[model samples]
Target: MEASPSTQSPATKARLRTKTGCSTCRQRRIKCGEEKPACRNCISASRGCVWPGPEELDRRLRKFREQLYPKTTAATKATVIVNNVTPLSPTLLPTDIFSLAELDLIHHWLNVLSDLLVLPNADPACVAGHSFETLRMMTGCSGLKSAILACSASNKSTLSKDPRYQVASLRYYDEAIRYVSDAVADIGHGSKAPSDMLITAMTYLWGPDGELDARKHVAAAITLMKIRYQTAPKQICDSLAASWWYRVVYESVLYQAFFLAIRKPLSPDFDVDPELFQLQGESQHLEPFATVLERQPLILGLPLSLYYLMIAVIKTPQLPEAQRQAQLLELRAELALWETLTDDDKPDADVHSKFQANAVALFVLATSLLLDQMCEQCLLAGSPAELTTTSHTRWQVFAALRLLHRPDVSEMWKRCYLGAWPILVVGYSAHEEEHISSIRSMLRQMVERTGYGEFQRILEELEGLWASKR
Candidate 1:
């Protein structure tokens, strides 16, 4: 073996390589004088002087396709996909690349959105009263930061409605994908469990537009959790287990409901017979992480339980008539039981408590939304097989809508960044014209007051649904 010639000396390496120039100027054998970022020569020639990163950075020459997909968007950058490699995936960015505005956005996500989501959004560090820099200093992970920046941009886009925020949102979203892919890739090559920050950030990305991204991160988080289920150090395992079920999974469930609202109908075809599947319950065993459910709060657990139960009820197209009716009765009884229990939880001043109370109520309303329809199909279905003409249907849907607007609800929206989907879903399913009018009025008010693109989008979707119904 040509005994691998000894490694080249640093002096020799330095002498052999030119110090600095834009990749384009270097390729063209021209003097670059490396004008800081872009080369003067490249600037004069109207070509991009892609600077390689500080590490090795022979630098890049931006091609036409770069604008097609940017790593991050400026307030003024054109919005489009960066043809980085794939549309769904982009290359990771260096951690230190954030500008002041980008940094501010990231902090906003940390202090506000992350704090609100502490219960269900998986932000393990309930970072209140802390600066972004402080948190960054305490725990540093590029993948987690990238994910946070992505969510911040996405949330900002909802509030700003500016094309720039949309551009930024897309940019950060791709950056998050790239970062996570690299982190997971490292794990595949022989790393231990992924950073808890990545799991925390994954839960924050739960929203209408980012559900698939959220799920992608979740799948990876679950894998790591399973791999370390038995063998990891207790400290590491505890970090992963801290509210892992309550924050990570429950938050995803909430977003899943939001995303499904306009994208597809929640229930399978009403006419099809639902198969036998375990209904969601507070008591079910989740492999490797049973403690999540075992210890989850009823405030959160109640809605989650309803979500599963409701999902089952809507799919009851082929059920044995007797069993279907019995299940419906059982669910009704459960809803009533929860309502009675939650009365004790409904405090007057604590916004967090109020929000949770309202959330539980919304779950019941959402379940009722489907149950009403399911019950109306025929004599075999139940007594009231028609939801369209029922005054009770109007009242139930409207009641849910009102709970969402209670004084504390707006506070919940400000902090948690909850979407308007569930509120609108109840309205969308409302058959009463008066109830429908109130829903429209409520949505319009929310959009005009908040300028949140989500509300505006909800308004547009509602209109579309109404148009189709008409």
Candidate 2:
């Protein structure tokens, strides 16, 4: 063995496993160099080089802190005050302003606000002080914070069944609405406020008085958005702020308003131009809500807005099939856009995914509308067999019915039912048994979840259609 050592070949080296790419790159199925500081691939692509693991970031932060202050005391750490009695001004900004960290803080507060609005037994007063502090820290404009605080306070009191609490809640809602209105007015006067401020204001206004003055507020909000679209920079106008997301929120407000407006008079004073209200391509003359989705594809508001827009249109008599088809095509485009954005391996992938799900739900709604249109056309043309030809018409309708009952489809059902019910009636009358049975099952599920009035109306409509057939 000693003699043969020089002649013996070197032992083969073990194969080394290379580290995989960052999470974002892996998700996108892209190659990554996985370099330090910033990944080479991300830098080359001009994208953010976010690491794969939060643990790595946490470790780095801990190490940095240790290096900065080896003997730092507990008292030196910043403490966020959950409760403070100081009244926030309507137009003041915190000293440390303008950073991603600040934006995250604002988002956190908004989440808390959302939770307070929806969560049963959530204490509004306990949250009020924190809300005020959060508003103060996040917004430079004191008026905006005050309005947010007012809404936060109102959300707390509104949960109570007692008349006193109800009154208090209304008062808070009114105060918040007024402050937000003032802020909006201030923006019109050349104040450099973010467009989101207006959205937040509208949210609070509708949140409280949705059952009262939603239509009027919705109209006002749309007018404001249109004005901004016209005058704001082209970049801002072309961006998400000007797009369907804003319109979607407006549509939601309008839907609530429509429900309330049913009790109000439909005189010349409240009349809007029918053509202008149609959901079609963007135009200056169109209702702001209708154009929002067309302008912004990535915004979650597009689907919601489309859902409500369809509801509004369906309630009206004599909607042209051509127009409906055009709108459905536009919604399909929006869904495609949402898929593209969500599929990107970006930091906001989770949010984009949520938005994609919402878009799918909206697509389901659009399919339902298309189905309704097809059924209506069949009835009008006296071609009963055309309704169940197993072609695009029948399949689309069936697919929509299937999606309507899906767990992920709940958010848009209220709007879906508005469109679906009419189609169901027409289908039942035409003796399309398969479609009728499917729609009936979906409606039954809806009855358990929707309000009493809506459920009763749908049931009555179904019964009346059946009686007419008999």
Candidate 3:
């Protein structure tokens, strides 16, 4: 859900040859380059020559808006601000900046990380589109801000191969933990306090450079949420409903499921779809494969459903064998349905839609993994070559990866950000040397393109797995 591309005004579109613009002009992001004390542009513009402070950013943005959108009324501009400026804690990902490297990390978080967190067609209001837009709306919350900084710095270290950045990340992480812990301990009847505590705990998992106990943090948040829901003031509840608090919960659950390889409890009351989609329109350009499992209502409604079901089974290992068997049979039947579904699935025509269709196939494959666990049967699962072309988990993953070769999907394919998880399992099942080589090559490319450390680790694990068998 990256922010819609800003329409570059004709005046601000070009890099005015102001390689030496004054502090004031630079701050305003306007064009100007002249002698100190009073540049001609400044004099003509009737502005001070001194360095404009951060406080003046709003004024400059307004001036630019007036110039560019002259026809827009004040009320219309306010509407724009409301829609565009859902600030998430002053856009601070580093907490505090020191060197240019840290600054670059912040930039990356704003641009790339935000994109990775959301889909291209996601609702901007729901997802943290661009960091600035989110930062604009975020009110003060030190612990949450610190956790975000830690995550950013962690990513920066991974991307830049700079160990020094980890230092700041660790500091911020520790600060967030301390603040959040204290707040939780002293939750003495304040309505907003519990929400703040929960937000801090949820955000900690997203931070970098630590063996964070995510389950503990989540438990704290859950406990606080129960208390807050019952006792919090109406205003606070409304704010939490509209704010990213639910997003925090979603992320925490995802982290627990992904990293721990287990499911957390899903409250019947919890639902995030309304936040994700407002207009219940069709799949847009992605309609060709609309009936595929990826496009299926269930998977689309909750992409994380497979993960949730897996976690539930794992968490409730105490379930009776009869109940377990019944559940497994039900899930397996669901998987079988997806296995035969291919009517509009292959969209080689539109590469963008093809990428999405393949994504759905990946989800179907994920379903297979759980089915194998439940039925204790291979059920179309085997070595890469042995896999059924249309259905098997290994085959689907291979097929999905193959789609990346298309020029349209190649650019995104190179970015291992989205498909890492599926690849990990796909690589694990690669028995043949050629299949193993292909998976390895794909992961290496993903690592090179995204600087996502996990891709490299997955590649190494797969290599080790293959080696051990040999």
Candidate 4:
């Protein structure tokens, strides 16, 4: 019962006028006197005279030329043959021809990136090749063509500083930010439940600029965790909710710890004191591993394991000497917990291994930041005895950096040390631009190879630090 294309109503054709008229007169739904160039209506209306109506414009000129010289029979036949070729079908249009499978592949790639952000210890390399493959396929999609153009126009490192690219990048980054914000708003009103993947997506999307708004996302995540924790049956707690709750707690605490480490204050509206502090404390006492051992296979345990460790580092700067000493004792306890998880008897060996690696990297970074802060404290308090401890802390951080062979981690350490180096060296009368230049050159090379754009921001931060010192 499909309608035939040939049976469809024919389009109305516009009629040709023999008279010339003003452009305005032709468009006004009025009749024009059949006159030559510069019609009577145009002259009365004070409009510029225009020649020929839409349909008659070309035909009249052709007729006038035909009067001067007629076309041969062969030329007329060639024109007839040219008009016989039909236009391309709608289904075969450039934009309509993409395979559904290609669209699904692009969706999968986007989801993988989302997975990396929320899940702690996710391997970015797992989707490395897939990203390029998706980009290749996406080139065919006309909808994505505009995105490709925008991405290409704004992708240069140097041009990132230009105002035009800055505006475009902000637009793209804002769209992503708005997406997370909308999800958080949904969870806040209890209108929608928060998923683990959603939390991961928020965390993954957060860049340096995201530090300010992260508390909102973290709060929503915590609310979801509390709801899940309370509503799940006891049997489900052992079988399902435990690992899920742990991830929620871990990521929530990790983001909070990151905020604290960066010296950003928590929002006044966030008042879930117990949930915040509870995750900050040792996970062993907070949640029993024995209860969740069977379900560990289904959860990522690394974020939970590293949460306590990172919190210890975040607490270092604010803690008094006695409190820090006590916390170090607790840190040793948490480190022991980490060691125990790596034991052969652990139920989820793969998760434990990844968690161990991430924990080691975070612990090292936290330790470095702690040592840097401690060094600053000692200098301020004029404590000469603490210098030895400071040196030992630096050595520990250096050794830890060696253990973590990741380029991103290594670059972070380099910047941290670079910030502290001037203080250490200049204090001891060893300041030199050559030394600074050499480090800068090395960092530039690292940035070129890795394409981690945040380091450029770090470099600017370092410049400010050096300027402040001088």
Candidate 5:
């Protein structure tokens, strides 16, 4: 074979030449330009540029470090010197058990999820340190961290239509449930007072977009708050400056309870908690718990009057028929008081709803319609009052739909989460094909922008309702 040497170069014969290249090129056993985003080979082939994930990179780095400095002490392994230049320490790398994928999800939480959880704050100065405070609260709780990861993953799945993230979301969700179960078991021992952190963990476990049942998570949060109120009544009365729990736990539980009330009607046999009613009564007072009564930054913001009224509505189903009707009338009056209030001392209704189809107005109108519907369901249908209620409900539905189609409100509706309940109410009451189509379009746009699949779920329910009507 001393014949003329082969013309081919050694580079062409190398088997591991593209080992550090894009996944597709490496699989194809070809040279890669190693370009970012998309390599030349992938672009030409019209293939996706799939890079190694964080976990894979972490493993590769660990393997390299071990080979370079095997079985070394901490000091020796701390820094790896190269050609008289000091290199970054190996310890500086992410060496913890928490994978980089989860870290990315946490980053998503900081950037997007937190903002989605609440309406814009009225006072920007008060929220200047909110991020640090939230991190401190989440630092020690594994269950809370897992719940957050689960939510983040679910959000990503919705946006990207990726099956992998959904799988990961479910796994983290199951782990969170197990951790919460263990924590509840520990609570039976009275070893720890139900702190706001633990209670907040329960609040985060409510999966709005996932397939998991949310009722249990909400019930757990309510139970934990009840425990806290019973065991540490003093803590409940503390000022916001003294304890952040007063705002976080109270508002979170209240918001969840409000939605639960809307979605699942209370059974006649369900017992009303005495503390819940006490909280409702105290919210109407001017002093003592005035700060508690005042609306803080919340997921749902309503007039102080409306907030209290919703709590009563949530409990109304538990009352006897005669008493329930009386309570409903009382709530209707209270709602009217807020809607028409122009007293110097009272909150201006316009301040809450500047837009024709603003969230607050939509909510008030929707709640009004809901109260009337409940009355009809619970009482005999032939009363003169029934005609007025039905007419008023239809009027509110048409008003909401008209406002919804305006140019200005269309932009607002794209970003607002609070419109959800009202939109659902309008969708349910809507019978005409045009009206139904408009509501469906708005929901689809919201899902496209926010990646909140809960809207999609609502859309599905509305379609099912429409199908039945046809």
Candidate 6:
């Protein structure tokens, strides 16, 4: 009782033919001799050939499979249940989703930017692995990805002197700002603590123009730390100390805060709350803080204790004259101790470590000189011995600067842009023409070598200072 095949409806017939050929062949309504890259039919017809891209093809195949075999049976349901428990597919990770441009930026980050961001002494393999893991965890998150890309692009702009790179960086920064703002707002609503990605993104929101107020970001980061984890100082310290990335970011924030506090303490826009970072009463927490610094000595190429001393100096201005003088002397003694330790250790350390030691020593010496000047200015009197000591420290600082300028550490200096703050401090404290000239030359070379335009701002500020002094 079956109907004849010729009379059968077209819908009842099986479809064995696949539309895998070029678009030209498909559009022409002709059979296509499917070929890789180009179909023979299109070639013969002298037509342009275009095929589905990988994502399109994948979507098409997935749609076809789903349509062909719709799940129905109990066995199918059981299979789905098992699949739910399986590990995430590799395709779901960052690699499969990144655009070509994003991939190139990531490659650059892995090769260069990672070195700039991580602990200087951290193993490259370990840092790369950590970065990869971070990317994987943040696969679909634009905040971290955009931040990383923005940083890379900004650096590229400086290096290549291409304004287009800066434009791209700004675009990425804008996108990242949207995501980070949302996250921060959510956290403000008592959603949860900020993630590592969010924290890291906050750290990277700065641009070449130096328009961003770093004190704001630093304060936000510290505030989040306090609000999220109201635990004892030890628990907080332990958690942060366990992760080198956290430590690096924290140290960087501290470095920026110290620099801003020292350079523009009274500036309205740059003002930060001393209580937010007050460690004076956290005597029990000092051990943990010291432990972290001991383990990651000079990660950002500055003595951690120097930051503490800066905080002490800032706090001392509010104290009684006698107490302030006592604290200043104590700070001076600590600076002297650091200078001695770094000098003794420099000869036995590696080139990178030696550079760090000298960099820290340079800052210590400069800080000592500045502290003496503060005493002389505030008291309007300085003993003959204090004047001699100040002169000696200035000479020692210049000597350390010369050591840093040596050929052996040229490559080291080029890689370490964190030297910017120390260099600026030294430049600000320099009085002699020869020392000022040396500092100016070093700043220009640092800007040229590291491609950090922020240093250019520092150079300009120093120029203004020198002009005023003249």
Candidate with best lDDT: 6
How well is each residue in 428-459 modelled by candidate 3, as lDDT tens digits? 55677777777788787666545566677678
Better of 4 and 6 by TM-score: 6
Off by over 4 Å in 5: 1-97, 121-128, 137-139, 208-212, 234-236, 239-246, 264-274, 280-293, 311-331, 341-357, 374-393, 402-412
Off by over 4 Å in 2: 1-109, 115-143, 150-165, 180-199, 238-470
lDDT of each: 0.50, 0.43, 0.50, 0.40, 0.59, 0.60
Per-residue accuracy of model 1 over 142-210 as CA lDDT, tens digit each: 555656666667655654445666677677667667776776788789857665555455554544254
TM-score on alpha carbons, each prediction = 0.59, 0.41, 0.59, 0.44, 0.66, 0.68
Model 4, 300-416: lDDT tens per residue? 333443543544444454557767656656665555555443223334456435444544444434444444454465447644222222323244343333433344344333322
Kindly list the per-residue Cα lDDT of model 5 for residues 350-396, writing each as its tens digit: 43244421555666666676676666666763432222233222766
Off by over 4 Å in 6: 1-96, 119-121, 231-242, 263-290, 314-327, 381-393, 429-433
* Candidate 2 local lDDT, 1-470, one digit each (tens): 23355654465222322324565576677777655445788878888765544233333334554675587433222111121112221112222452322232243234333332321122333234334443543356544554444444333232222244345446656666676677667776885643655654664465444445656766665556555545563544354343433333334444433434322211112333344344556644444434444433322233444444444433333346466546545544644544343223334444334434444453444434444554464447533223333333444444455544445434445323243333443343334666667666656544433221344455566667656655
Task: Please report the TM-score between candidate 5 and the true structure.
Answer: 0.66
RMSD of 1: 14.0
lDDT of candidate 6 over 69-109, digit per residue (tens): 47544533432332222211122223347764565456545
Candidate 5's clash total is 0
Q: Evaluate candidate 3 by giving its C-alpha RMSD to the native, one decimal.
A: 14.3
Best-performing candidate as measured by TM-score: 6
